[model samples]
Target chain A: MSDEKKLAIIATKGTLDWGYPPFILASTAAALGYETQVFFTFYGLQLVRKKLDLKVSPLGNPGMPMPMGMDKWFPVLGTALPGMESVMSSMMKKKMRDKGVASLQELRDLCFEAEVKMIACQMTVDLFDFNPADFVDGLEFGGAATFFEFAGESDICLFI
Target chain B: MAAFDQELDATGLNCPLPILRAKKTLSGMEAGQVLRIVATDPGSVKDFEAFSKQTGNELLESGEEAGKFVFLLKKA
Candidate 1:
């Protein structure tokens, strides 16, 4: 509308697999010279947590394919396993590293360097008992009103 | 004259970086300039092609050389 493209990325998932979509899209939008904002809410707040790397494992997810077995026959064992998410996250990270994709930390740093705005949803932070210190520096804390204000002028709005 | 000459070595950089760098460099140049980008990432080939099409830039020459990709772009 203002001859400048705007993009808003809503991050709602905290899993490792779910973490990539928002960062990737936001980074790409910023690289394209668009006004890009990434709003972290709900479990997605874990992505911005300084201590949590947000890893996921492929095993135990009913949605994930088992190595050589049919997923449907694998039983409910998929969701019952502990630490599968982290394992999957590590595996995915390894795969990306092998293929030369930038690490999540690198991507975050690059996004900041490129001037992508990052916002943390206050409601989720309160619900999760997370403090501002838990997140990376330069993250703004706001509510739905703030998100709507930012998203009102966006040409692209995505929830990932 | 040979249009213009620019070189970009984006080897080992993945998608978006190469495209981002190229876009940044191209934005600073005048039209009709030629930019040569060298990259090793396979995804960059398609990424640059799409970038060229989307940005209205021209892909004058694109080929592979000894495991490296070479792209010649003309700013439009």
Candidate 2:
């Protein structure tokens, strides 16, 4: 085998908060000259969609801090309010922008430019009845065995 | 004010972006050419060091000026 390192990641979440780690790590790995592949399974397949509609939900996320001193006094009840998720999602997006953290689309674009392999799980697509045309161009569709072929030889394998 | 063949301004970008930019820029440069980069992300200080070690690029200088992190990298 070649001496170049390999990185394999299985992306299993679709939430905006959870969507970042896989792309960030994969892009950085590609930047470092590692052969990188990301397998998007289940809800994670949303990341490869042509139009991204990711959102973060504050409900049941105790670690998420509420704005305006609400975290200390408001408890989890406030999260139950209608449209709370959209509110939290917008706030998180603003924070990321202010901190200069790359948006999910930007990170994905970097990965694409760096030639990182992005594979979407075919099983999940069939289960969800998703149209293959809904995803971005240059994506590969495969099953678990296909991912295992690369992951088995990877120096670093992550499930995120 | 170090002499460099190229310069990359990664200001207002955070983790991974600055490094990614540097990597892309360096790939197109000739070997032995020097690249100077300025970034606002505080985390780049450590990230660049690790990047240099991993990629075999030489990190000639790493310092901060006016709160922005500066780096000089010599392509390997």
Q: How many clashing pairs per prediction, in order?
A: 7, 0
Alpha carbon deviation, residue B72, candidate 2 (Å): 0.1
Candidate 2, A33-72: lDDT as tens digits: 9999999999999899999989999889888877787778
Report the C-alpha lDDT of model 1 over A64-159, residue by residue, as the tens digit. 654446455645665456775665566677777877677777777777877889999999888878888989998999999999998998999998
TM-scores of all predicted structures: 0.80, 0.97
Q: What is the interface RMSD of each candidate, in Å?
A: 2.2, 0.6
Docking class of 1: acceptable
Displacement of residue A153 (Cα, Å) in model 1 is: 1.2
Q: TM-score of predicted model 1?
A: 0.80
Classified by CAPRI criteria, candidate 2 counts as high
Residue A140 error, candidate 1, Å: 0.8
Chain B TM (all candidates):
0.91, 0.97
- Top candidate on lDDT is 2
